[model samples]
Structures are given as structure tokens and as C-alpha cells.
Target: MALFWFLHLYLSQFKWITALLQKHSEIRMRGIDLPDDLIVEVLSLLPVKSLLQLKCVNKSWNSLISDPKFVKLHLQLSTPNRNLALVQYDRPDCRVLTFPLNHLLHNPSTTIPTHQFICKDNIQFQVIGSCHGLICLLRKSYTSDHTNIHFRFWNPATRVISKELGSFQQSNYHAHDRHRYIFGYDNFTGSYKVVLMCSGKVKIFNIGDNIWTEISSFPRFDHDVSLGSDRVNNGVYLNGTVNWIAFQDDLSCSTYSWMQRDTTLEQYMIILLDLGTETYKQLQPPRGDGVNLVVPRFEPTIAVLMDCLCFSHYVKRTHFIIWKMTKFGFEQSWTQFLKISFQNLQVDNNFSDWNQYQTFMFPLCLSENGETLILASSLPGLCQVILYNLRRNRVERTKDLGRIWSFAKDYVESLASIR
Candidate 1:
């Protein structure tokens, strides 16, 4: 009787323990039931590529990740100031490709292999500018009576393309046409606006409303003065304004009018177009002796660093002076950001050939914390991307890739969807 009682008690205790463990296992498999907000906060720290892969875990996760609000939040929380190179190679064929910055920064042996994203576009175009993860691409067909210059808004990350957003029915596609466009988002209106700039004609198009309205006309230049096309200037979108280096045409008489001179007589200025008020203003370039140098090739490049307008001007071969604005629209706030010398670099055989091609270096991307600047050189032959460690005061060169000048832009991967 005693043995039977003992055996029965042992069996009951074992069964109860097993049942408790089974319940615990079920909780573990289902997860701890974290709060939705907390889950999103944690998930937002992940890269978009990983987030897309995690969507298949369950329905709840899929819905959470697919939410537009979540995507915007994720974009806000994403790691900024990272290096992602958008390479547009014009050789063999015109192609837009992307690669990790470290591929060009670190030693080949120590470099982590990053997948190169070769974007496939159905139409022939060139990237004009990128904002809020939406890249603006320009495609021109001059066969028609009016110049059919179309803009394509593409979110390379989400693979969403907004085709035929707008077009400029230009009178004629002049090789020396100064027509350009800037795509920017207006915080006040909560809409994306494209600023169309020509020699004298200026217009603004609101993407959300799908309407184009003529704004104030650009400051006119004398007929004798030469007006430059978009290729001759650098266009930057910042603070709901489009900023570009506008040049005053040189009208001085020369013996050889058509001759290509090593030195130019043009003066560069910053042209600002406010998206909110539809106004135009010009900011003085950073006051310096180097800023006065005539640019034989396009040299006055504009960029945005942490809500401040930054300008880069080259004095001579590979020597550039960087200026930053501490206060927006304040000329007094302009300060020398950094002085970089690429002339001392250990150039390879291609470097000479690059110089002959009138190659120039421009800022491609800046690292998080703004410590490093990755620059690409436009060269006809293989040229390495140059990485400058601003903090360490060090200059490093990568292996020879295609001419650093291959069509490339600073690209950021995001989940921004464009319908």
C-alpha cells in the first residue's frame, strides 16, 4: 500500500512538471509579447535589407514593417553620414552602379566583400539629384519639335519608380543650355517640389498637387555674356531651397574666340531658390583668394552638411578649399571648413591620364560623424576613389576602379516607396 501511494505521487508530480515546462515552451516560441512600439523601436535599428527579410517571420511582423509610418521612422533612425557610392559608368555603356565605401577605403585583403547594386533602368538617363531617398533622373529626347526633357523619380531601395513626373518642353536642346532642375521636399507644405531653372525662365512644380507654376524669373545675363548649362554647375537641395554655383558669363574679346583656353574668366556665385516663398536670392561665395580663381573645368561644387550650406572650390590641381556656413543665409557665417591636398597622393599610371581627361574630384559621400570624405575623380581611365580621414588627417587611396568620374552620386538605401 505504501509503495503504491509513493508511486502514484511520483507520477503526478512528474506529469505536473512536464505540463508546466510545456506551457513555458509555448510562451518562449510565441515570444514575450513585447509592446508594438517597443518592437518597432528595436526593429528600426536594423538595416532595411535585414528588415525586409524579417517580414516573412509572421503576419504581425509583416504588417508592422510594411507600415508607411514605420518606414519613415526607420528612415529617421537610420545610420546617417555613411558612405555609399553611386557609380555611373559611361564607358562601354552608360550604367548606374553602387558599391560600399569600405570597398574603396580599406585594404583589399581586409576589405569585406559588399554586393554591388547595379541598378537596371529601362530608359537612358542620368541622375540629377537625390533627396529623401528619391533620386531625380533626367532623360532628354531632342528628336521632337520641343525638347522633351523628362524627369523620373526613382526610389532605388524600394525599386519604385515615379515615371513621367514632369517634363520641360524646351524650345530647342541647346548644347550650351543652362536649364537645370532641383528636387526637394518642403516641410511647410509637406510636399516635394522641383525647381526648374533656365537662363531666364524659372518654374516650380509641386509633386503632390501635380501642378507646375512659374515662379520668379532668374536674373538675366547680358547677351554678350556666356550662360552655362547644368553640366557646368553643381546643384544642391537644402532647407527647401535649391542652391547651385551660378557663373557670370565672360564676354571679353579674345583673338581665338572658339579656342579652348586653360584658364576661364567666369565668376562663380551661389544662387538660392526658396521653395516656400518662391523667391530667389544670391549668396556670396566664401571670401578668399582661391574663390576668385577662374575655373577652366566645373569646380565650384555645393553640398549640405548638417543643415549648413557647404561649398568647395578648387584653386589648382587637386587642391580644394572647403567652406561651411554656420548660420543659414548669412554671409558672415561662412567659415573655412577644411583644406585638402590631393597633389601629394601617390598617383598610379592612370593618374596622369586622368588629368589629361580634365578629371576633377568632387565630394561623393561623407561618413557618419563627418570624419571622412569620399571623393570620386572623373577620369577616362581607371582611377581610384580617394578617401580623406578628416579626423586623423590622413589620406588613403583605393585600388584602381573605373574612372572615379564614372557617373556616380551619393546614394542612401531606404524603404521610401514612391507611387
Candidate 2:
């Protein structure tokens, strides 16, 4: 991979030479044309900015670059160039600030530069999920009677956004009847989809079709083990499915009586919905030998690290451990990725409340080299980003990021179109 990227950079340096060659009479007279495969190979390595500019060079080149196959190829090669899309909602208009991952990784002390996208009409928006280059968002507009909610898709690289697609009324207005939205791609159908989990029911919206269809509801744990709160955010999307970390309480009368004498025995598992099949499946967390895994006072969060589903949780209220799934849907595939102590992160464990001391730490993004991780450590009203060095097992840098709703997402620039 290093050698391939070195060659890509080497070829990119000669872009001016290619333009100069086109001006030469000898090359013009020969009318030499590169083969389609060769053209795609070179173009796919260039950044999205350069490809967008080159599209105007000629009609054939424009068509080749716009082809769906080429788009997929470019996206595959663009993974290493991922960006950090940080969404700040405190402003009247929500702003998505895009920062190059390389810049943040290389210049830890410098003031990083960013590209900003301001929301229109000063409407408030909350990020649902980011996949490919498209960001799914929930827009809330105030009306005289109530708030109107809509779903919108935005591609910051192409600067093309879809109009508000659909509005859903709450199936139940109870206090605990909260809804969560997740965005992902359907590899089988070659479409982008949005999954909505509302009041225990599931619904899907296909971007190309601009239609929402009801799907199977989340599986209910055997009646006694009631499902717990679903305050999940930015679910991990991989292999045509979106996964969330959910818990079930052992609410049986006998279990409740036992809990009074014993301890809380809430079982946490991964709840994933396959986009192709529109069905739900559950996978238990890793139970390594000699390790008793249980849901922390707060909960563990899941993310995609190194293209694998990872689980991050607090251990003994002292260490933060992350586990990665080597194979999707395989319980035994879970491997410990890293373990960092609170002392290493400089976390204060002096809070009066035990739950406050067990702060929620979320893994936001991981560096391409896999040596550093961007984490969001959240307290009641405070949230901050920590850049941790995996090799040294220490914190590299800390930034407040002002105020953010949640952790930043690992974003990529692509030409994936949305309808």
C-alpha cells in the first residue's frame, strides 16, 4: 500500500508534464490516445478535486469519469484520503467543517485549516450518519403547532444535496419512544439507504427511489428481558448492514429479586439490520478467557476501525479497552485492539457520583497508519477530542473542539451521486 501510494504521488507530480506533452506538435500529430483501462487507473488515483476539474477537459473523459464503475473504483482508492467531518450545532445554522485527516495527523500543533458548509435558511440539523461521501441529516424546522422533521442528504465534495425527502410522525409519543436514524449503503442493490428505528419498529428509505418502506422490527428479547433505551448514535455501517450496541434488562420477577441481593445483570449485544434482507440479527460481545465482560455503568459504543467492527468500553472504571471483530457476525472473532488506562488519558476519577466518574469515551476515528486514534470523552456538559498514540500508549494532543453534538465522523470525498 505504501509503494502504491508512492507511485500515485510520483505520477501526480507529472500532471503538468502531461499537459505540456499535449501541446507538442509531434504528440498532436501522432494522435496517441491512452486505452480506457489505463486512463481509469491513473484518474482514479487523483484526488476528487482534480477529477472534477479534469471532467471539463473533453467529452469522452467526462463520460469516463462519471461512469458508475469508475466512481466505485475512485472511492476504493480514496479511502486513505479520508477527512474529518465535524458537525457543530450550537450556531443558529448547523455547520459541517471538513478537515483533511493527513493535516491533523502530520501537524498536531498547528491551527488546522477546514472547509465549511453552512446550512441553508439557518435551519437546525443533526447528523444521522455519513457513508461514502453522502451525509444523512435530520432537519428540524419550527412551526406554529409543532416541529417538522425531514431527512436530507448532502455530498460536500460535489456540493450537491438532495431536497428533504420524507417526514415521519412519531408512531408513539411516549417519553421513551425515541427514534434513531442510521445511514448506509446497500451493496446488493447498489443504493444508499437510511434506516429509522422508531418505537421498536424499523423503516428504510432508498435514496434513488425516494421512498420509505417498513421493514421487520427489532427483535424483542424474550419477554422478561425487556429491551433498554436506544439512545445510539452514528451506528457502524459495514458489509451492507448497520449495527448498534443495545442492551436488554433481566426484568423477570425472580431476576429482579436476585438483583436486589446481587448486582445488575443487563446483557448487551450488537443489533444489526441487513440492508439487503431488511432483517435484524444479534451478536454477543467478546467473552475472552478470564475476562468477565458486562455492560459498564454507562454503555460501550461500537465503531468501524481498520474496516472492522470495534467495541469500546470502560473496564473497572480505570481502563478503556477496544475490541475488533476479525470476521463479521462471528463471536469468536473479537480481538482486543488496544487497552489504555485512565491515568494515560489524564481522566479525573474524583467525581462524587460513581456514574460521573464512569464517563463515556467514544472512538471517533482512527488514523490510516493505525497508530493513532481520535476519541471523544464526554461528561454531562463537556465534550472534547483526544488524539491518542497507539504505539506509545499515550495521549498525543487534546482539543476542546468548542462544542459538538457527538464525536466527529471519518469522512471520505467521493463522486457518489444521490437523487
Local distance difference test, candidate 2 = 0.68
Per-residue lDDT for 43-149 in model 2, tens only? 78777777888787778879998999999999987545687666676556676666777776776565534335445447776677789888777876765545667
Q: lDDT per residue, candidate 1, 1-419, as tens digits?
A: 34234433543454422442344356558885545665576567566666776677678889988988888888898664233434444444445545555555555323323344445444356767777777777776665556677777777665678868777667754645556667787867868888776555677888877778886455563211222223324477887888776555343333134224443423556777778877778777777654455554434677776567888766555567678999888877888888876554333323333234343556666666578776666544435566778888777766555553334566567776656
Model 2 pairs whose backbones collide: none
How many clashing residue pairs appear in each of the predictions shown? 4, 0
Candidate 2 regions with alpha-carbon error over 4 angstroms: 1-29, 112-115, 171-176, 221-234, 249-266, 288-291, 294-296, 353-359, 380-382, 405-407
Return the TM-score for each candidate structure: 0.75, 0.85
TM-score, cand. 2: 0.85
Worst 10 residues of 1 by lDDT: 221-230
Report how far residue 7 has shifted in candidate 2, in Å: 9.1
Determine the backbone clash count of candidate 2. Answer: 0
Give the number of the best model, judged by TM-score.
2
Off by over 4 Å in 1: 1-33, 58-60, 81-93, 107-117, 121-123, 142-147, 171-175, 221-232, 248-266, 289-298, 316-318, 346-359, 380-382, 391-393, 399-406
